[model samples]
Target: MPFWLSWAVWSAPVKKLGARPAISSGCSGVTMLNWLTAQHLVGLPGMPTTVQGVNARAKREGWEAQLRLGRGGGQEYSFAVLPKETQTALLMREVAQQEPAPAQQLQQPGAAQVVNSPKRDAYTESRLNDDQRSVMAARMVLIREIERMSKVVSQQRAIDTLVGLARTGSLSPYLAERAERANDRKNADRALSERTLKRWLADYRKHGEIALAPARRKPNMSVPVWAADFLKHYQRPQKPSAQAAYLAFQREYPGAPSLHAVQRFLAKLSPQAREMGRMGPREAKALLPYNKRLTDHMWPNDVWVADGHKFDAEVINPNSGQIFRPEVTSIIDWATRRIVGFAINVAESTLATLDALHSGISRVGMFRVFYVDNGSGFANDTIREVVERLGGEMTHSLPYNSQARGVIERAHRTIMVRLAKDFDSYIGADMDGEAGNKVHRISRADLKKGSQPRHIPTLNEFYERLAIALDEYNHSPHRGLTKIRDSETGRFRHPSPMEAWRRAEAEGFAALQPSTELSMLLVRPQDLRRTHRGLVRTNGANYFLQDLVPLHGDQVRVAWDYRDASKVAVFTLDGDLIGQAILDGNASDAMPRIVKDQDRRVSGQLAKLVQKGKTLTGKDVELRVIERPAEDDRFQQHLLEAEKFVALAHEPEADALEAPDNEMTRYDRWQQLDSRQRLGEALSDDEARWHASYPNHPDFKSIQRMYDHFEAEQARA
Candidate 1:
């Protein structure tokens, strides 16, 4: 019989009894043969030919039930009829059984649909310890194994196998091998005891796969106040040790946990928390994940990093003949890791930084960004302006964060620090203390003796060696660079910094050309006064040119190299460069004319004093002779005779001077008379008094010659 037709006729709720009805209680019921006939009456195939076949089919379908005849000698048998709702449910169940499996359904067209479960309002899983998470992971493996096994065998059979394994305290061969490979005991358990399995099954039915995870123990809520206080104090930069914190805690609160407990607590803390407690905030911050700056698409000259490193080795200063550590300011290309420029200075200063930046820009062309640390040399207005003028933006790393400028910092270690190791005077951070001190002492003694130390190289020699090292570094293979074939060698090799730079340039990453005015922008500026002589004096040297005369006495901007003050670039207050000025070596050598005139006046005053002394001495001798009574009359007679002789001598010269015949002579005679009168009057003063005391002085003839020459000049006029 067809399965559906037989099922409908036999399982129908209503049934009719047979005609022989008085022997047994005949409630309306159908026998197996009658049910079969009913199936044929419905135009379907009759039931199985034998009665046994009909009864076997009904029992297999779970529709057979035994019922007793009421008050009868024996019981009658009939199939229990299903209700209408039961029939419909069974029909639906049969239809579902014929449907394809879930995996098979996914392979069919239009079978994919989003299935959304109710969103959880609270956390689905709490934080788990490492051990708990590991245990949960192992249990999850077992659950997946069961699920996979159920596809090939009955679920009951799979459960029975797992239960048998758990009773014998053994695991599946696959799980045992995995546990041995992993060296984890927890993963070796792939089965559960019957009781445990039953509990797991109940949990799975309630909460799905999540219930397979191990439950965590409740956290201790009654933490002592002292423990909290200790944690707070321990994480400080001073970083008290756990024992020290525990000791302190005991003093503050006697009810705190024991030292062993505290130690255990610390051991279980998160790595970041432990680092914070023992190391410092800086170390703790390092534990956190940070976004890495990506430069994959960056080209050479896109960014440049600059920093100043105090060279570890002492070098001789050429100008001063002294040994000192020099600061090396360097600029590196971000993409190629190549050193583009560097400069050495006695200290880290704006001029030094500018020199490095200028060298880089001039050699490689302009860049787009300039990265630097927040150093006084780099964070100034001048550097900022110079960077902007070079068509780049200047960015400063966070304070005390050298990692941000790590390219140049690492370059210092890789190049300069390594170079310093070859020198005996290296005072590197890792140098042995006694040796460094001894070397330093010897160098100091040499300086005191006015001699150069053999251990140190001169500045020029240092620069020469540094250049070699830098060249080697730039051409060396770098891990950051991509591998490429060498064009000349025709062999595979890692790309060098210079090779990378060339490639970038060829690929349209060409650098911008800098202007001629770019260098002037990098120099240090000073407000200086220009002398009236067109000279500007700085550092005891006068810088000037003929063109600067117009700016004399005006306060103008003077830009010059601090290390070389022999020349300066002169600029107006409005930033116009007038001209360059050379040092005037003799600017301070010349004296003013007024000083010479003062020297002449002082010499004349000394001469007059000497003449006055002589006059006074002669007068004293004459007075002594006149004071003697015996010689008084004789002296008087002698003075009168001398006066008469002087008068006669003067009369003839005066008459000769007055003698004039023509108009010019008449004028000369008048001038001679006027000069004689004026001369007589001048002789009555101090000069004449000194001369009159010594009338026979040798200077008298020269004086008379001076007056005669004056008369002759007047006669000609």
Candidate 2:
């Protein structure tokens, strides 16, 4: 038998039995060259025997499986058994080669007409660069290309081609070059393995192009549940560290994320969120952008910023001769950066703020806006009313945001703090030492020790110095002010507050002339009572006004100048100005001089009486009574006679005096005898004669009896 026939016989059983070809245990697969050699078909002259030589020849000859099994390092691949039909076809083709074809058959018309598979058009490149395109978008493009190829070729064939390309790392020339540059040899050689291609194909079959992109890692919802509790514990004023918070989180959630994870999450938080845990809300809020308001285009009196700063230096109280720190209230013109007005008091009060505002408006003009902090003195209804009445609005800075009142705050630092440094009693924020040192600096011990009579200036002297300093400040060139040409000199110069005011006036932004009446409206009114004597009392002083005389016994509104108690403006309930009252005298005395003098004299007399040990008794009372004149004797006798006459007139009529029946004549004769005995003056002549004639007459007696009977009957009825 021929060697080919023997090789064919040896491979026939493996093909028929449907079993893998027998090979060495170390090498389960055979290369195309090795299989061809085993068949004893290698005797052709100049035919290469190596796998590389075979692969080159197979590639040129368009043999797919043979070329794939014969490429570089392909000799180690598992052998792919040919099908029985394929084996029979190979044998038949070999037999045909042995027998020459007839000329007629070879020359048959159109006998070699080629049948070619459909060729797909090359995929159009994407306009987006690799970096610009998302990984998922690129994958989608690739999936679309694969699907398009599947329409022209078999689905399995297309998938196998893609797998082969991926395994051989020949998907794209650019991608291969990029992999080479990155020195990723494994990835460059095998960009996507067969397993990866199969996974992608399976995904594409199931979910279309979306499946070509890598699946996202599922979000750990469980981690968020623990993280939420962690954040709640972490973001606090106490400001626990991430590790501390993680430990705390375990208490709330048994299975929390690790501390490292918590730290990474915290690091990803916003600046404000991170700051909020360490600092409080107020401080954290400061991290946000603020709307910076500028007053560049504003006129000199457009906005006035006001604030009260406690003076850092001690000054002697003139009245008490004691050293004390005073509070200074200052108002600054926002546009000009000028301290328009200021006031100093032993302490900050609404009165101090009012006075400062009043002075500012009086000197610089009415402002359009009053910017202030939420201080008790500046948040006053009186101050608000003052600003509103002046055709301005009052705006309060947000709590804890002092920057809103920057103008006045800066003024407090620039003017007051600078001035304070000149005094030995300076105790400002930047002062060197603690509270005790500051207290010792202002202590009265030095004065008690007769150390040069203590050098602290009196309040009045300090006020004078402050006034001079303010004048200098108003004239000094202001940094915030812009340069302006002097009208008189026609030369450019940096504008001071005074210069700014002058320039504003020249430019027709003249200030509104202050009205004293409007200013008085801002003065705080005190409900006070006026005495019937036309006196009003306040602040331990009695005030009197001629206009208040008629207003006595009425409740009046008294508004006084805080700086001076000499006079106060009094108004009625209806806001009618009654009159100004002058400080008359101390309210402690509260009495007319004459009355007070009398009381003093009475007190002195009582003191003298007590010194003499004099006491009142019955003998003293009898002596005092004996000093009076006695009553008249005649008057006593008249009183006794009148008493007896009154007793006789009231005596009841006796029953024996009444005579019955015809006893009328006897009664009439008795009446005549009683009348003659009682008569003080004699009757007229006619009366006397008639009485004598009818004295004992029976007719007279009968008439008298009838009258008596009529009287008795009338009385009974």
Best by TM-score: 1
Worst 10 residues of 1 by lDDT: 108-117
Cα deviation at 126, candidate 1, in Å, is 13
Candidate 1: where are CA atoms >4 Å away?
1-193, 197-224, 271-284, 481-494, 521-526, 549-551, 574-577, 585-717
Clashes of each: 0, 1
TM-score of each: 0.56, 0.47
lDDT of 2 by residue, 338-390 (tens): 88878777777888887787767655667888888888888878777767777
The residue pairs that clash in candidate 2, if any, are 29-79
List where candidate 2 sits over 4 angstroms from the true fold.
1-226, 240-262, 321-323, 434-457, 476-495, 517-527, 546-551, 571-580, 585-717
RMSD of 1: 35.2
Cα error, residue 602 of model 2, in Å, equals: 35
lDDT of 2 at 659: 26
